[model samples]
Target: MCRTSILPSTVKAVKRGEAGSAGELRGDFDLSGDLGPLYANTGSGIFGRLEEAPRAGAAVPVGMALPGPATILANVRGDEVREYDIEILKVAPSSADGRDLVLSVTDPELLEETGGIVQGMSGSPILQNGKLVGAVTHVLLNNPEKGYGILIDHMLEAAGDGVD
Candidate 1:
């Protein structure tokens, strides 16, 4: 299990009714510099068609195990930011076959606001002992309040030109 904190500058909000579809959320952060070039191919030739289509019914994996008491500072009703304690119930890895970080939350308030996962919260950099660990990804459809995260090391590695 991994524990991390949220960076202030990383916090963003999606206007109540303006969040787009899931695909939009995944691409919310500009990961080009971090993950290298993402490609899209439509040609029929072998090399030209290297980009594989996203799985039709596959779920992105979350990683690690559920963490113990985590603190959530979220805007509750009346625009008041409230803090709550959370426990990670589970974690899955990212779906990219790369080192992605994802996890499940056990906090009710956060679950409600994010419906497990929401936009504007995608790039919330998670920290542990002041060290970045990951960023929020998406919410699990079956459990709307549970979300995914991308491991910080993976993000750093991707961003660092793949240096160890």
Candidate 2:
């Protein structure tokens, strides 16, 4: 599908509390440009393959470790990118999805900002030591202050068609 992308902006646009209506499509996407070809669309995340040669910059190579300081960029309610400081608590090679890195939200202002991670936050890129390690994939339902991140390397390898 050329015009296929299941973005948070599109998903959030669905109107709720309607009669005899699954949802409504009215709001425009917050993306600067279209999201390319979409391969997998799930409730948890979307897997899309970029349809281009290759672009330089923006994405950093996946880092090997995550034990120190890191930063996360996430869009909580719309297109507003918010930065939060965090510290890697632990890393496990085997998780629910094979490998997952645990993170502790150390940003002093995060809780007061949005009551910790809210909806539509998974897949937020996680940068450690100025390198892209992975993304915030899941947050503990009981404890919102902590979350799980999937290594970028692991994701690229899983793509099969290679990363763009």
Top candidate (lDDT): 2
- Regions of candidate 2 where Cα sits further than 4 Å from its true position: 1-3, 6-33, 41-45, 50-57
lDDT of 1 at 111: 55
- Assess every candidate by TM-score: 0.44, 0.71
Off by over 4 Å in 1: 1-66, 71-86, 90-99, 128-130, 161-164
**Model 1 collision count:** 16
Question: How many pairs of residues collide in model 2?
Answer: 0
Per-residue C-alpha lDDT of model 1 across residues 1-164, encoded as one tens digit per residue: 43222111222343321234331122133323231222221111001121344334343333333344443434434434444444444344445632254455566656545544555445444443323445655555555455566665455445443222
Q: How accurate is candidate 1 locally (lDDT)?
A: 0.41
The lDDT per prediction is 0.41, 0.63
Q: Kindly give the stretch of ten consecutive residues in candidate 2 with the minimal lDDT sum.
A: 16-25
- Candidate topping TM-score: 2
* Position 56, candidate 1: lDDT: 46
**C-alpha RMSD (angstroms) for model 1:** 13.8
